[model samples]
Target: MEWLETRELRYFTAVAEELHFGRAAERLGMAQPPLSRAVQRLERRLGVALLDRGRHGVALTPAGAVLLDEARATLDAAAAAARRTRRAVEPGGRLVLAVKANGAHDLLRALLDAYAREPDAAEVEVVLCGIGEDERMLRDGRADAALLHPLYSSLAGFDSEEVLTEEQVVVLPAGHPLAARTSLTLAEVADVPGLPAARWPLRDGGYPPGPGPEVRDLSQLAQLIALGRTSTVIPASARAWLWTAHSAVPLVDAPSVTTHIAWPPQSRSRPLAALVRTAVGLGRQA
Candidate 1:
């Protein structure tokens, strides 16, 4: 049996992740041909083919799929070990915080305070991930911790904490009579034709990069209702996140949106308690 080194696993993982040799090479800041050769070498060492080359791109083989997970784990453990070593030397290692949606910036700020207050003076790195990206980052160990929506909990190996409960809102056309109602109710709009539930593109990225704008001004969402055809229901936090003029009407007694804090089930915490406390506080203030 051949002994495997960390470097090969790292390279292989990136290639598996990108699924395109060129893209993976670019991500690693290396040239494509060598990256391809390295992957070839790894397959030779392992005595198995890991990828299925393709005209469009590449796909993982059955062995490649198994290897991808193992490769990711190997890289994660190595990274974790390096971080621990640095912290042992300097008593401070950078933490990566992955959050769903940018509005969680307040929580990030609180988390920073908590980390800074730690005796080790740990460094915090915050990543504002799209709605579904948090769990992947945590399990892969790319991020030290994450604040994700509870709905995304099925991501395999992560545990979640219910950190915040938020209210809902009714978004109406700017000129709709309901917009003048001061307060809105879902029951009232249930029969009033179209309510914008948003077909949600089968993929929820939270906010897409270089947005065409999700709500594109609540007034427009209201206008969707104003089409006198459809009404929109959004979380009250949408007020915090997408407030634009008198475009959305707040509702009462609606189901609260739950925000979750997530991490790998077996993950450790540097200043976990403080981080949780600060997260709760940020939610309260919202």
Candidate 2:
């Protein structure tokens, strides 16, 4: 088979995701017939049936499901290549760093300040992202680097250096009995009466099965904790920002959270290297 065009992959991906050619066509800003033909051509070239059309609806065959995943990755890589190429040729290059909002706490401030002191440090632009968003930003070239936690962020495709490792702590209402404890185990906090653990949105923007209130950010979670409606576990450093109405107890058995400065494995930017060095040095000091 000859090389497959990105256009064909994109068309097929949209159709596979939506399972409705008309909707996918509308999304692609093209007519349904052409989009349908494109997908058909792609299927013919691959010599396989991608979609099963019936009176009821459209569905993906086994091969179609596999292609959807690969096609999405390929599209993202192509886009990233284009974006990075443009950024490289700009008059004054800058490095964009993605960090989860309310994450990295005091360490972020220190990293930025220390890097700025470097003689020729490229201007570092910080992009504050939502939960589990730093990885996506890095993958799509929206960010040059990211400060991510190993527990919640995937580092499969990136080279990372550990910046800080700290124990986890459970945040609860100041008035709650558990708040008075010096340290609590995970089991002790799991089923707190009237204070179920807060549920955070997943990458798909859906909350995991839970009875607790759904929270999108730390600010909302903090408010819920203060109101005695919900509780959550977070890195120990986060305690520095808790409201007066909130109290934190270290989780004895909870896993330690490690913050890493991560960048694409193929990154060869000098500025990014210098920034990583600064972060590593600061981590050693701490």
TM-score of each: 0.55, 0.92
How far in Å is the alpha carbon of 180 misplaced in model 2? 2.2
Encode model 1's per-residue lDDT on 232-276: one tens digit a residue: 565555454443433677777566667776655554555554565
lDDT of 2 by residue, 53-85 (tens): 999999999999999999999999999878877
lDDT of 1: 0.64
Q: Every model's Cα RMSD, please?
A: 6.6, 2.0
In model 1, what lDDT does residue 157 have?
Answer: 59
Model 1 spans with C-alpha error above 4 angstroms: 1-4, 10-60, 69-98, 101-130, 133-143, 152-155, 180-233, 242-244, 247-256, 264-270, 277-286
Off by over 4 Å in 2: 55-57
